[model samples]
Target: MKIVATEGCHLIGKNGERWIDGMASWWSACHGYNHPHVREAVTAQLQRMPHVMFGGITHDPAERLASRLAEVAPDDLNHVFFSDSGSVAVEVAMKMAIGHWRRHDRPGRTRFLAFENAYHGDTTGAMSLCDPQRSMHARYSGAITQQFHVPLPRDETTETNLDRVLAEHSDSIAGVFVEPLVQGAGGMRFHDVNTLTRIRDACRRHDLLLIADEIATGFQRTGKMFAVDHTADLPSPVVPDILCLGKALTAGTMSMAVTIARSHVFDSFYSDDPGAALMHGPTFMANPL
Candidate 1:
């Protein structure tokens, strides 16, 4: 039979039986389906202002959400790059990392490092940072940039492995991408916070940018506002150079995602020459309805 409606955490199928939605609609519907509050908000939004392209314009929902995010984000991650979905958010983060290095005059540091069994998203650039042996896009290996893969550490001691990986490829590494404490798409593998802290330390020591893919762990899903909040073992709180977020940006009401970076990272795109500006953007980049 087919499910027709949802309330609270239960779904009502055609048979009239109520069942809990264990997967939460691919893990994005934190508030579940047919939630009264969500329904009202969406309906109200549709009446007032339904759709708007963000290519060069802004709307109330987008602006309010961006402001809320900046207020809640970690220090200096005040900038927000909006996209339609998580996959696109990942692509934005990757591009920002590359641009950050290029703008800083480190053009040769173009390679990226990600953990084995870590899944960022399905986009081409996101897929490249994923370990092909464990990623679904193994067949499309030739299309990706072939990032270095570090095995997820089982304990704090595994910091040595991260050090070794950085030592071997520090020169070419542009950034180190991670899924934080829990590697969601990789069968929900859980690692220690110290492991993330170590990775962060290694990235800083080697001058590599740290990109936290918190798409799955944002919005208190993991009992924290962001997964990086769990990393208290580091000498200081580790703030990623770039952060990719989605799924809960608008309480899952709208299809929205954001790529937040430090101001310096954004500065790279500022130039007198039009060609020097970051040329990558979707047609809906700043569209407003």
Candidate 2:
């Protein structure tokens, strides 16, 4: 369908047929369309600056946004890396997980343990992290790096299987990748907080990094700042070592995503040696406008 215009939460087509934007522009337009506040900010930003390279040159909006993200992010996830899309954010999280181990001299711990019926993104690296059997990217299996995909921890049997998989592949598994309470795309599946705790416990027991892909559930979509915040109710609250956020980050005003890491994860790359630094840098990483 051709969306000629959008107002509030509805889309207007060529024939002026209006339809509620139920999906929120693929779950990114959380604030609806043509919001005056958003428009004003964009207009003001445009008058001053639209886009600028984030390499060596720094800008106020990017710095302020980075600080705001750190302030609102769960736990000590204070470090942020920006990208232009959700898929790229997920890919960055994957790279961070694998690189964390490699920097610590455990290069063999390379692959990730992601859940079945989970969809991270469509990029080659992110595609492999999705459900290998059920994802639309299944046809590209041979082209992407294969990771471990297992069932969500919804029951004792599945939980046991998860434990077993982690135990058996502990040496090779760098981390656990999950969508937290709700899984999107592969299926709009929802698992309770206990299931999340089980995954967190398993990751803790095996000493593996936990990467939460909140691309679909961030910005209070799931009644929480981020889906991982539900874990705060557990006896021992848990947080992911790395968190991926996107979709509503700009409230659909523009395409933007972020991969945030905790202090320890960020510290691994903080060394005088140039090789120890995180090597990847996107061109439009922290576009001011």
Candidate 3:
């Protein structure tokens, strides 16, 4: 039951009744629909280039967008691995995390740890990390891998519980994926940034990569440029080894997402063997227009 829109935050249906959009079309219209600026940009791009497969080629729009994202993203997240949506971006982050350890001679550390009630995307890897209690896919248990889920603790026992979970399963954990401050789609559950810092420290201590799924918390949604900025005031700020971004990548104009990782993670794919080349990519891998 998708509604048709004729203007920003306004919709016209089959019955021709116009109404203000409160639902915002499943919450994807960040600037609403039919925004003037967005329309103008799309119009201009359409005039210049309508479409081109982003495989083994480059284009100005993608390059410029990547440059802008790099400038605004965290200090260390300079690289951008683009995808068409948030789900694929989450998959990319997971693949990078696993590949990192495999390249470093630690293939046994393949398990991932995610907070309970966390929601990254709908893909298999993303669904695996999400709490089944909140997901509709709970009935299809065998469809995805099981990930360690740490309960979101209250102020009194947050640190203690987190430490206990990490200690219990730290040996086989490859990475920890978190939603930073606010866990959107999980009832908008919010946690203190300090809790993220503590988890970050625990991951570091356990030699596990920290992956931040900031698809919903990025780009000033949390009153900061990124939720990670909120943790900067902590004794040890949490800087994830990999950052997943989407939703507002183009301010919601285009369906684009990215996974930014440290140089070492990218290095894993730099090998002579084609099998080790991260044999996964979309047809539009490097579209140019």
Which has the greatest lDDT?
A: 2
User: What is candidate 3's lDDT per residue for 1-289, written digit by digit as tens?
Assistant: 3555567777888677788877555455678777888888888878888778776677998888778877877666777888877888889988888888888888877788888788878878888888866665576566788888877654548767777777787667889899988888887888887678777777877778889988887877788888998877766677788998878656556667788886677788888887787655676543332
Count backbone clashes in candidate 1: 13
Residues 92-143 of candidate 2 have per-residue lDDT tens digits of 9878888899988889998999988889998888898989889888888777
Give the TM-score of each candidate: 0.91, 0.97, 0.89
Error of 2 at 246 (Å): 0.4
Off by over 4 Å in 1: 154-157, 232-235, 283-289
Model 2: which ten-residue window has the lowest total lDDT?
280-289
- lDDT (tens digit, per residue) of candidate 1 on 1-289: 6888777778798878999878776577887776788788778867887766555566776677678888888888888887777888888887787777887888878778888888888888888877788777778877768888878655555667878888888778888988988888888888777677778778878888899999888888788788888754456887888899988666655566788887778788777978667666665542222
Locate the minimum summed-lDDT window of 10 residues in model 3: 280-289
lDDT of 1: 0.79
* TM-score order of candidates, top first: 2, 1, 3
For candidate 3, the per-residue lDDT at 58 reads 76
Could you say which candidate leads in TM-score?
2
* Model 2 pairs whose backbones collide: none
